[model samples]
Target: MILTADVLENAFVRLEPFEPSMRAEVRSALDCDPDSWGGMVAAAYGPHFDGWWTAAMAAMCAGSRIPWAVRRQSDGAVIGTTSLYEIRPEHRRCEVGSTFYRPETRGGPVNPACKRLLLDHAFAAGAVRVEIITDTLNPASQAAIRKLGARDEGVLARHKITWTGRIRDTAQFAILDLDWPKVRQLLDDRIAGFSES
Candidate 1:
């Protein structure tokens, strides 16, 4: 499917096109949890965010990724960013990663809602496979991926070094198009339950 920096929204959160104008709000919101990126590649503070934003925009410009500023729907506050990257239309596959949320928004409804939107869009775009990978050391993320109904595809040893110079073992997970029906139902049920609570 054709991917663009289109605004994507569900009941709980809104994914707006990432723009330079959104820097301050996003940075401010991310400041709510300064160490949020500890498990990931980018830093959330100081000039590091600028570097991350630049690379993100570059990927968008090159049509390799579509990034969004994740905003809480209830209050329209920027919460974090998520993207569909490594888009391979011919292969009908893409990766969902580079996601970060404000600390307070973690362990809540935001992530499930966002993933629902991204997965829905990816499959609609003719994706046969959608991947979600995390550092092997991150149990929280591993659990989240499992909850998405993605089958464990094992790990890639010495995947990539983080910004902190830590060698990471990447835990790979994926949901195939054939599995979408069941996985979508699970995510839908989770979002509904989350919305209720």
Candidate 2:
């Protein structure tokens, strides 16, 4: 169920699946920007992520509904991670979240290019709707989703008190396949505008 045709190419980045050899690189990338989500993720899974990324990567490699991976390029350095989770075949919907990128990759073509790859893949996989949810406080991520043309569905107030004991507000966004032609065109324009030298 390789939801996507394969890796997507753009002027600055490529979104592809996590591979076995990427273990160390992924660990390295996740290690940076510790103040962001380091304690939440890396410390919990760092030592054995080689197997974890491998398993997760294998699932995506198997074309499972939740195919996911750490983002990188020909350089094989992991800069971010995202996944198509909570898939509902009957509903023709799935979520695109659990995404994080190193600070270095921010405000670069990397983020948009990665999103373009995911969105195209989801729509191309016959999904009627692809959604993304971001913590309300994470303005950067929220803005990025909006820039991609996703409509604000709603806010899940106090969605779930995290283990850290913080009540999180989630801002949801979605792009239906019906909007792909236009959204894709919009992304193309944005990517072009940003990549211009």
Candidate 3:
């Protein structure tokens, strides 16, 4: 079973469970600047968003995924989406992926803040491992994951079929239950830095 989609929030961001009401807000955020999703799966932006949303909704209803709409606290606008997919309750693992943000918020506190909340929730939900993977071509994504203190687990060649119909290699990273202490501190420091600036 997937973890419950409880509201997760911090000073910078709030992750709310996805629902039909968020469609317009999320669509508007993603449609603002197409470039923000350049390295991500093509469907995440542009004309394919509708199809992607449909599939995601189906997954949520199937109990295999929990989706969240990331929102900024200052204005309470949806900025992007993220999810816990491939959830395996028996194995106590899940993938904290399918994440994206608006271009202006890319290098700010939102990502780390969201990650901290998600990680905390996952571990607290009895997850022993939380995996995050990115397209191999996305160095920025790889770097961000590293900063979260997750260890690299190498690449998976031809792991996914992108929206553009290309076979893509994926870079895998993971954080085990044992690594949470240090990782949590790393995240706390990062969030503090954001608040300072």
Clashing pairs in 1: 1-125
Task: Give TM per candidate.
Answer: 0.95, 0.80, 0.95
lDDT of 2 by residue, 102-137 (tens): 887788777777778788877877899988887787
Per-residue lDDT of candidate 3, residues 55-171 (tens digit): 888888887788899999999889888899888999999999889888778899999999999999999999999999999998999999998999999999989887667788999
Pick by TM-score: 1 or 3, better one: 1
Best by TM-score: 1
lDDT per model, in order? 0.88, 0.69, 0.87
lDDT against true structure, model 3: 0.87
lDDT of candidate 1 over 70-136, digit per residue (tens): 9999999898888999998888899999888877788999999999999998998889999999999
Clashing pairs in 3: none
In model 3, the number of clashes is 0
- Give the poorly placed runs of model 1, Cα more than 4 Å off: none
Model 1 is weakest, by summed lDDT over 10 consecutive residues, at 29-38
Candidate 3 or 2, higher lDDT: 3
